[model samples]
Target: MSLKPSSRDWQRAIADARQGLSAWHVWNLLAMTDIRQRYKRSRVGPFWITLSMAAFVGGIGLVYSTLFKQDIRTYLPYLAVNYVVWTLIQGIIMDATGVFSSSGVYLRQEAMPKTLFAMRLIMRNLIMFAHNIIIIPLVFLLFGVWPDWEMLLAIPGMIMLLVAAYPVVMLIGMISTRFRDTPVIIQNVLQIAFFLTPIMWKVDQLGAAAPFVVGLNPFAIFLRIVAEPMNGRAPSLWTWGVAILVIVLLYAITGPLFARLRARIVYWL
Candidate 1:
């Protein structure tokens, strides 16, 4: 005799299967697809991100370091790394904010996952970010800079940063879906933030303005977790632990909150 499963059993099975599908795996596949789509008609493909980054770094490096009266060797890489990280942050924030709107058709018409859309945005940014990363090594080689053991510390630190960043992205995506004006406001604020945050010059190099830049800046707080290690300084264990802890808290709190609101998102749109 064949038996039919109860409603609860079907729901539980679906949940279990989703839980088993790792976020990392989803991110990797989505990221790859995003890169391919981004370069669909282009000859150079995803290398465009790298090429553009190189031009930006080279162009800005020549102008900014000259204006700042700093050496290009030291300043160029700093500018490149900072700009890459800043771009990724902006992409994540903006992408999350528009996740619902951008995927409105799919959300309304299809059975495809909502969380996957957000994940895809993050993954897409990461893939582009990785492509841009090629500029780092090229710059390093041109400048004759070498990564010491301290630089190796950046791998784990960046991993921590990515983990900490996702839930924040998801939360922003959910909140912005409820507020249509958020995207425009975010664009203006991001422009202001670009100037406010230190990209080309070190905070310490900013002289008296250093304290305000360090203590009050949210981007500074976020960068502290990853930038130091990336720039060849070993990140503190305490800082890494704190960043990871924050990630855990964000997931634990936002997961259920987002889930409850997930179904209502379509109505809002």
Candidate 2:
């Protein structure tokens, strides 16, 4: 046997990727295993992340509240929510770089869809996100911030976020597998994006420039979709529209590239 995959193999790879979504049990098991192995033999397990997140949020909230001259009652909860969501966004993007490369063993051993690895990565982070998010309710209670019905809007907001993140993960995973340096570059870009996006500070602080700054950042728009609802107000329709538009644009650019590169991933890895 030649062992070289043909054009039909590439098409099947793409088709398998789509089919992988329905193979929920496979990815879900792999994701859970990843989480377990990560925290195995650790005393506190994943709660360590939750504890560290609480401490970091508390420390930052205190200093920033003082510096920004904002009341702790309001500011801490805002900071907590922003940090949690930002952590999820940052983790997903950064980890996407390794979705293929790190799973080289499984790829070589079994006929698996690349999308399965992506889902496993996302699910692992979501598990960690679940652990870190317990602090949110605590912050809400401590600050006496009661979210209203508007908070339900966060459901759709989170759905939009995950939907947008999928293509980015695929694109980055493919590129990073090919270029060893891509992960480092992605980390640097994410660091810059962190400050550019409104996470630690309010967008309004930028004055008239706020609109221009926030308008260009899909991260900011996605953040607003979730954060605004928790803040007791629904995000504007325009924000939702912009987030969907960004998702569409990302898919448009990445879809063809991913199709071309899907089967070649193992070779690069």
Candidate 3:
């Protein structure tokens, strides 16, 4: 009758999350199984992810370097960090919209914590990200790139990424499971976002429009937090401020919405 999340509902949501997190072995198994099934019978298993990313970086780095008239050494590493970070971001979100519905059979059969599926999704993408990141060290070696102390900041940046993933995946998974078409719409928007984000181009190239673009685009903001540190530059303080703000806002919004809908979600699927 009422749409508000009652105190009991909020407690249940929190408990579900706490329990889901504590059950790491279950989610890890599910995540690893996903990777194995996806690459089954392949010669190198998930290394295919690394090889494909390497090809894209090499091919695009060469072509875009000439197009932008930038030096290959500089451009290639730049592209590698940005593209790899972007892949992790894009991959989680792309799969998140379908996470719950895809696992409907499991959810429908028994009592399962919804947050576990969210964790499973994050873990799966992280594995692919690990594979994809193999190219980074190789790129650094090939391009003679040296690490800077600033690169250490990427550790916190990565932690922030994982922290942000749980809520975002849970929120999107809930909504898309309720409304199937939401996934299609999100898929198209992500395609546009890929270009709007400065993955292949330096933000400086935007000149007068750079500030507005970065300020408004959360993708660019989060991307900078991780990629800039890896690229040997510390992100500006404002970027960190914005990223923390986005994480706060995401939890703020999803916490209540998830509490309200957590019970209803199974029916929707």
The TM-scores, one per candidate, come to 0.82, 0.94, 0.98
C-alpha lDDT score of every prediction, in listed order: 0.72, 0.87, 0.93
| Candidate 3 per-residue lDDT over residues 1-269, each given as its tens digit | 67689999999999999999999999999999999999899899999878888999999999999999999999999999999999999999989999999899899999999999999999999999999998999999998998989999999999999899888899899889988898998899899989989899999999999999876799998899899999999999899998999999999989999999999899998
Report lDDT (Cα) of residue 87, candidate 2.
92
* Candidate 1 minimal-lDDT segment of 10 residues: 1-10
- Sequence-dependent TM-score of model 3: 0.98
Residue 51 in candidate 2, Cα distance off native in Å: 0.4
Q: Which stretches of candidate 2 lie over 4 Å from their true place?
A: 1-14
- Output the number of the TM-score-best candidate: 3
> What lDDT does candidate 2 reach at residue 226?
84
- Candidate 2 lDDT tens digits, 165-218: 888888899889989899999999989988988788987789999888887788
- Any residue pairs clashing in model 3, and if so which? none
| Backbone clashes under 3 angstroms, per model | 0, 0, 0
Give the CA lDDT, 0 to 100, for residue 204 in model 2: 76
Candidate 1 to truth, TM:
0.82
**Model 1, span 122-233: residue lDDT tens:** 7788878887878888888888888877777667767766766667666777778888888888888888887887777777777898767654665654566556656776
